[model samples]
Target chain A: MDMKINIAGVELDNPIIAASGTYGFGHEYNEFYDISEIGAISVKGLTKSPRAGNPPPRITETIGGILNSVGLQNPGVDAFIKEEIPFLRKHRCKIIANMAGNTFEDYCEMAEKLSAADVDMLEMNISCPNVKAGGAAFGTNPDTVLAITKAVRTYAKKPLIVKLSPNVADITETAKAAEAGGADALSLINTLTGMAIDINTRRPILANVVGGLSGPCVKPVALRMVYQVHQAVKLPIIGMGGISNGDDAVEFLLAGSTAISVGTANFTDPYACLKIRDGIKTYMEKHQIKTVRELTGGLIVESK
Target chain B: MSYQDYSCQICSQQEIAPNIIACCLENAHLAKNAKPGQFLHIQCGDPASMPLRRPISICDVNGDELTIIYEVKGRGTKALREQTGKVQVLGPLGNGFLVDNSLYKRPAVIGGGIGTYPLYLLTKQLTNASVYLGFRNQSVVTLEQEFCQVAEKVTITTDDGSYGVSGFAITQLEEDHKKEVFDIVYACGPKPMLRAVQAFAEKTGVPCQLSLEERMGCGIGACLTCNCETHEEGSAHYKHVCKNGPVFWSQEVVL
Candidate 1:
């Protein structure tokens, strides 16, 4: 019934970590329950300068999921260190600073700055589709992924996790590029690029026109990609994309993810992570699994 | 600061107006903590199809029963209408309307269409308040008797001259303002109506609080989906409609 997971030397109490953007700075969900019960909290995506984000009608619902083009709206890294870090420091769970940038320099600068600050890990967000530049741009190209990951790796003092884009030709190519660039670990798949249009006005629902899709609808796709990337690379993967329940978390672990991150589920239920953790424990007890590590890459495939 | 998820039992459901249904839920905790402008994020139907929760404003609260009036506008509300037995709700969310009877005696409350539902609670809390409600026509007009019982004066208007005063409600509010100035103006409605109220509040130099709406995700500060532009000077040019406010000073927001 042990739920502990160690990612690149950083130990998590459980495998259920709150994903970036969906959980914000861990302030809102804390009102529902104590945030310390979860494994880790990945704060909202931050940048070198403050981003105003996209215009209104930023989100719309699709079948079993949602499309959002928030465009990395944050108060910049300096403000997060001064205003948010102190609050997160008081908590018992580990903190992962999710950082995005418009250029390699922006990535390196933030890496150097946040590495000196009070955060447990640094997650490079190179797959945000909402931003116009340097987000999905760097993640889709293997050479750019290697270059930026290597550049940020030089400055990041803590374990660096490169979050990959699902909107790519081959996810394993980029996963291999991140591995070659010295990433401590990998996390995927950052939302797929999609769009929704209103029929009456024949206008796009989101002001940005295109957005990233997340929720239960994308679970199957995310699982397939995680399985592919796991076979291609050696780095431990933090699989995320439409994980709602404990069974979903187990699917990710069996697909070869070292840990799992809950995103859209938090919106559906405030106590999603805690419920998912309990669900995992219940599954473990029923199956008589000794440790969570045994569940990783434990898929039973038919032998040829 | 305190909020929890409650599995509320559906005590009764009534169709107050065309396509508008009023449902009373039994939850003592939510009823006691709910304020005037706060809202509840409710999960409708099954989670497989309708994954997101709909944010419904508090219409009325009596003892341990909380009432929410919502129109069947989209798939979410359609799913909500079919709900029976019980529903999961997370509520009394966001900063509610600031009510200080000592500070403002004569208050003017204005609302249009479905927006008038949330104001019922506010009107009940105020002592010397005049209420103005507007709708498309007679078939959509609701809560007339409810407001009449609470407000010192009630003015109902319809755009097509189907019932009550024939014209926009703001026109009557402007005419009423000339005779006796109000200390404060509170409003919630369609954008056009809210825009007129905002201009009116600004021109008269009277303090105003407006309840705004947007397509929301988390119904909390966590998801930055529900955001509105503000006139405040800072790096953050926008405030979340779910957190910073579903209610804000008329002058503070851009509308």
Candidate 2:
């Protein structure tokens, strides 16, 4: 019955947070439904300065997934803090500022700026592959992960959630590195790098040639990584990747994630988070579970 | 505008030209509210099989029936071509065309190939508008008769000398402008054609609005996909084509 979740001292009425880049400042979705109905919203990826992003043809569809090369096109952090934060502050749910940068200084500057701002959490987006640099690079290596997480920790006054990259060799290593570097919590898995070709045109579908793949296709990989990282670290995990419904959210919760974020599913249905939240409630009721926390790490597997 | 996805009955489906199909659906709200240049994101295949919805421009809206014209581009549209009966769609979405009658009393409408589809709605709304359409050749020329019925004057052209006019549509528009000057120009088509119109608008000191086509993730503003750079004064800003516009002021965007 109780769907509340506490991630790094920040409380969510429910465990559904709209993933960054997928949910833009909550203005668009707010037009569809009362966005305050959802648990929280992670605004679009932000940087120190405005970014123009990639060229046209930034998105290409795949089997049960999509590849996006949006390149973090945003109106800069100052714009977000000036123009967007006040609007976001009007909502009842927590606001997680998803920050991306082309360099370490950019991340630190954004971390410091957002820390003193009105946001509830800082979600460091180190796994964006659509950009040329400082995106997936910081998330792929344990050293960079530790270094960036450590560096960002100094400036981030709010809870720091290091979003892990699935493109890495072992996700647990990076998750452990973030934990070692003082991450309050973690979220995963940012889209997996993939490409699709236009057979008719004999060219890549996306202008960027390669993009991060997300949606139902990557859910299994996301669940596996969340489970592995949960065992490797003691931090609460925000699991995501193709989470379309409450059943999918339940899968992530049982895989040791305290909460889940809806990404690609938001494209298919604007009220995906609300549906997912209701689905989890229905799932809990049917299973006679009292609280969603009971579903965390509830997976029963036999040792081979 | 409401953003919830709706399931509408497929009233009919007809192939208007080679590789192009016109689908008519019965959705009262969309038909009543959908404006020129607004699009619908239709669920192409089974929800489980295809997670991404295909964004299609509304070609015509009559009472409770909304028609969309699309060319088979990929697996999504290929699947859409086979859809029948009831289909789920999320839209009447994005910022539609702003047809400020005060901005331009007499307007010129230009369309290239599939780009001409959305202009049908725009031309219908304009009381006095000139329509110029360009295609590959006579064989692929579509909606010529429809434009002729709505437009004050209609000019059709082809890349090769096989149809109404011997040259590009922009050339025809330029030639016609000398005979009768247009207060404004509205266009949709290939990128180069749009770029040409943008230049023409600047050179002639006439206002122009262009509808852009970009690959999109969410036809709504959620996903930052479908980004197009816009220039205001000397600064450049990015806008989501799916949200901010499929249609923008001529000088506002960089083609």
Q: What lDDT would each prediction earn against the true structure?
A: 0.92, 0.89
State the lDDT of candidate 2 residue by residue for A131-212, as single tens digits.
8653787889999999999999999999999999999889999999999999999999999999999888999989899988
Instruction: Give per-residue CA lDDT, model 1, range A105-207, as digits (tens).
Output: 9999999999999999999999999996437889999999999999999999999999999999899999999999999999999999899999999999998
Q: What clash count does candidate 1 reach?
A: 0
Model 1: which residue pairs collide? none
Count backbone clashes in candidate 2: 1
Instruction: Please count the clashing residue pairs in each candidate, in the order shown.
Output: 0, 1
The weakest ten consecutive residues by lDDT in model 2 chain A span: A129-138
Candidate 2 residue-wise lDDT at A159 = 99
- Give the per-residue lDDT of model 1 (tens digit) for B1-255: 376889999998889888999999999999999999999999998776777899999999999999999999889999888888999999988888888999999899999999999999999999989999999999999999989999999999999999999999999999999988999999989999999999998899999999999999999889899888887544477898999899999988897
Candidate 1 residue A7 C-alpha distance from true site, Å: 0.7
Docking model 2 quality class: medium
Model 2, B95-163: lDDT tens digits are 777787777788999999999999999999888889999999988899988988888988899999798
